[model samples]
Target: MSKYILPVSVFGTVAGCAVLLKQYVTGGRCPSKATIHGKTVVITGANTGIGKETAEALAKRGGRIIMGCRDMEKCQAAAKEIRGKTLNSNVDAFHLDLASIKSIREFAERIKQEEKRVDILINNAGVMRCPAWKTEDGFDMQFGVNHLGHFLLTNLLLEKLKESAPSRVINVASLAHIIGKIDFEDLNWEKKKFDTKQAYCQSKLANVLFTRELAKRLQGKLRWLLH
Candidate 1:
């Protein structure tokens, strides 16, 4: 890690820890105010972190959740936890590993067979601060998992989103992306040395670009939903 990045990360961590400490002290209600009743929410990496929390929130709001994750055991556990906490909500995991294109293809096929339509798609699976590597399809690790994986998944499931008619795709991005630019030349980090944070930012930028492009196209299709 770079010298500047280390201090910044430490500061961010400390700030997060302070906020968490304050929350515990406050004993806040954090009441459920989600708008996902009767909606089907698909959250990748739903076994942990914000993904797990999102599924829980959706469940509390009477939403049916489909978890897309690589680890079946962890996914099942997460589903059980959600059900245990919330009251008889529908929460289950589907197999998905974003590192492989074949897995992405297979996941899309499985979704087609099972679900009639997807109301909300959260492309939340990502790798952060990991060692550099290339995917089986020869893309950069973070780029492959965070950007291309979601891009392919979105394209495959687009028809379902359209069928649902009021769907939303929320790809999580971070401020780390502000310094990144699209490197069309070495997008896969083939020639240049790979940096973990840089790779993350690039993938996040890809998501931002993708979202803008897709919203432009879908605006015409979803015109009726507008008030």
Candidate 2:
């Protein structure tokens, strides 16, 4: 019995540790019980991953969800799934290609014209490590899609956001920013040899910095949150 007790205790401890590790890795679950019945939420890259999960969660909370993605087919499919699961028909999909300024402008214009208010904006779209690629505007893909795209979208929607004062803007950044260094001279990677990892890190760092600056500039006007 004594030997058996020791093994059981060891197993219990291991199980407890594993549970804790998983919670830490996944950032645990949201504790908020608040609901946003009529609030409007616009999420970029909502076709999959973090963005999709966020849309579903918000939809469950009764917020109107607008999902923006580069792939309309996937975005529409995801919106339908979320609507079915959450029973929230407010979920809709819109095409937004961060790699192209034209597409971004068109999406923003549509949102401003169609949506009455923008309560929350989640800048969750991002591009990670990939071979050197340029945006339609001739900028590095990682930096262009991750930072510039969100920047422009946020700015373009500022009027609507301001109208819905007491609104929130959430920018999803990464820990990779810790090792990032921005090169102003060759921001587009035109002069320097392209490094996908470094470019991704730099873009993440830009996200952090941009959020900070935006928060400062907005001061008492609005709230900006970073993740």
Candidate with the greatest TM-score versus the true structure = 2
For candidate 1, lDDT tens digit of each residue in 1-227? 58799899999999999999878754566675656767888889999998998798888888889999999999999999999999745888889999999999999888878887788888888998788887888888899998999999989988888898777788877667778788999998778888888888898888888877887888865321100
For candidate 1, the 10 contiguous residues with the lowest summed lDDT are 218-227
The CA root-mean-square deviation of candidate 1, after full C-alpha superposition on the true structure, stands at: 7.6
- lDDT at 105 for candidate 2? 99
TM-score computed on alpha carbons, candidate 2 = 0.91
What tens-digit string does per-residue lDDT give for candidate 2 at 1-227? Answer: 79799899999999999999988866898999999998999999999999999999999999999999999999999999999999999999999999999999999999999999999999999999989999999999999999999999999999999999889999999989999999999998988899999999999999999999999999998899998
* Positional deviation of residue 10's Cα in model 1 after best superposition, in angstroms: 19
**What is the Å distance of residue 222 in model 2 from its true position?**
1.0
Clash count in backbone of candidate 1:
0
TM-score for candidate 1, please give it.
0.82
The CA lDDT of each predicted structure is 0.84, 0.96
